[model samples]
Target: MPPVNASREPMTLPRLTEDPVSPLSPGTHTITVRHGLSRIEQRYHVAGTGPVCIAHPGGPGIGWEYLRMPQLERSLTMVYIEPVGTGASGFLADPRAYTVTTYAHFLRAVIEHLALPDVVLLGHSHGGFVAQRYALDQPERVEALVLYDTSPVTGEEFWSAAVANLERFVQRHVDERPEVARYVAALTTRLDQLTDEGATAVLRTIMPAYVCDYWGREEEFGPARRSLRMYAAPTRGDGQPFDVRDELSAVAAPTLVLVGSDDFICGPHWARMIHQGIPEAQLTVLDETGHLAHLERPEEFRSVMTGFLALEREDAH
Candidate 1:
């Protein structure tokens, strides 16, 4: 994979300048820290009042708003991050330097800046990729991990499976919804080098397939799609393809692999892969749902998550 941001400027690794104490107040905050000689402002929103759970949304681009679990917030302090290069977070000088390693490094820096000894890390989609990398890189810093709707690898095989699954989705709906084929056919959205509007458009176009019953239950999920905000960051590519099958065993954090059974991309197959890779990991698959399991079944999702969190909290003693 190539760098999406075309700037030839130098890239710097994110590092902490000082041991800063930041309270997790109910609001959004930005932390500007050293990224080599450059600086990257880490942006995050805090809500809720229980044990802290750092939630990382996917997209390497999608806004963190969609990943907000209001139900979970009732019990868990949700720290939703607007990853660098997206939203108000400072951009990397060399956008091409974006990779799982880089993201994990920045994530660790931000975590350290927050002064939390360890964190319950929840990552969805591409955010899951970053979480896995971070867990492997700094297992001691991760109190627990939630790998949601993500895969440990990304390449031809991974994408081929997604296409096949998307085709299946198209076939399933084409008979009833004649326009399903058009929606699937028009999905020529480039995975790299996307602008904010372009990323949002691409996601909106594919939302039908991304969620198992998105279109069927439009009234319930319509507001989500209409209010979707995106800030396209550079694709996470540092010349090598993303894969962590062998490295997964190194993750010491207790992990919960959660996914929607009907999720075309990063479905049960990947979930099982992650579950099996991590030692004593738990796997929970929500049936009839797609990528957005939390959105589709908020109560059930929150129940399972809080249950897991409670158990983890107990074991922390």
Candidate 2:
């Protein structure tokens, strides 16, 4: 993959930032922290007094903004953050520096900095990978794990499907706008060059295709479409090839793996695999839904999550 934001100059941006429409109640104070010279920062949106839940974005570089997951925020004090190189967070100059382990470390830092206990991690897509890894590494820190539309890990076996889908997605976008094919190709190729910061720029340009068939409200879809476009600029020429299947047993947290029944990307079967791997995990297949289950069916998503959280609360009591 090529770099999405490389074409533009790299500047030092705010290490941590706040969301304009935080799901947390007004007057709540959230903190952002910068650790080390790298631009990897964490954004905390604190509210509610029950337990702490950290929300990780999916794309390797996409920030937490795309996922408002307001339902979860309303129930628990939620912390949404930009991965190493996306959003208001600074980008690592080294593209190789962008790996799942480092991202998980950053997540740990956020949890420790906030001094949160009984932390429940809710990660979507790529973020799920992070949450899974974090649980495996720091099982004691995590109270529960919510894997939203992602597998325990991904590898050569899964790359074929992802590659095929991405190729089709890119082809469709290029077909929609032939003139931009070269740019699209270039951007996708540039995915590798992207330090984490460049990932957001790339996603903003190319992520829309995934949602072309998902959202009903064009108004709602419009912003999502724009987000996809930005991320599209960075291409994974060979795609990502890493597996965490062996680490599944290491996750001691009670896990809940949710999937959209109609998710073309990470379907229900994948969710089942996660449930089977994590001995304590529960799987829920959301019928008639797609990849963006939270956005597509917010109310149902909220209900499912709330029920799970409530269960955990009861068990704790």
Query: Which runs in model 2 stand beyond 4 Å of their true positions?
Result: 1-41, 47-49, 163-190, 193-209, 212-216, 227-240
Name the regions of candidate 1 deviating beyond 4 angstroms: 1-22, 185-188, 191-194, 236-239
Error of 2 at 41 (Å): 4.2
| Tens-digit lDDT track of model 1 for 1-317 | 11011111111212212323455777777788677788878888787888899988786666666777778888998888877877678888886777777778778877886789899999898889999989988888999999999999988888778878878888888898887776554454565666678766666666677776777788766656665566655553464668999999899998999999888888999999999899999999999988887777889999989999889889978
Q: How far in Å is the alpha carbon of 275 misplaced in model 1?
A: 1.1
lDDT of each: 0.77, 0.62
| TM-scores for candidates 1 onward, in order | 0.89, 0.75
- Model 1 CA lDDT for position 49: 84
* Index of the highest-lDDT prediction: 1
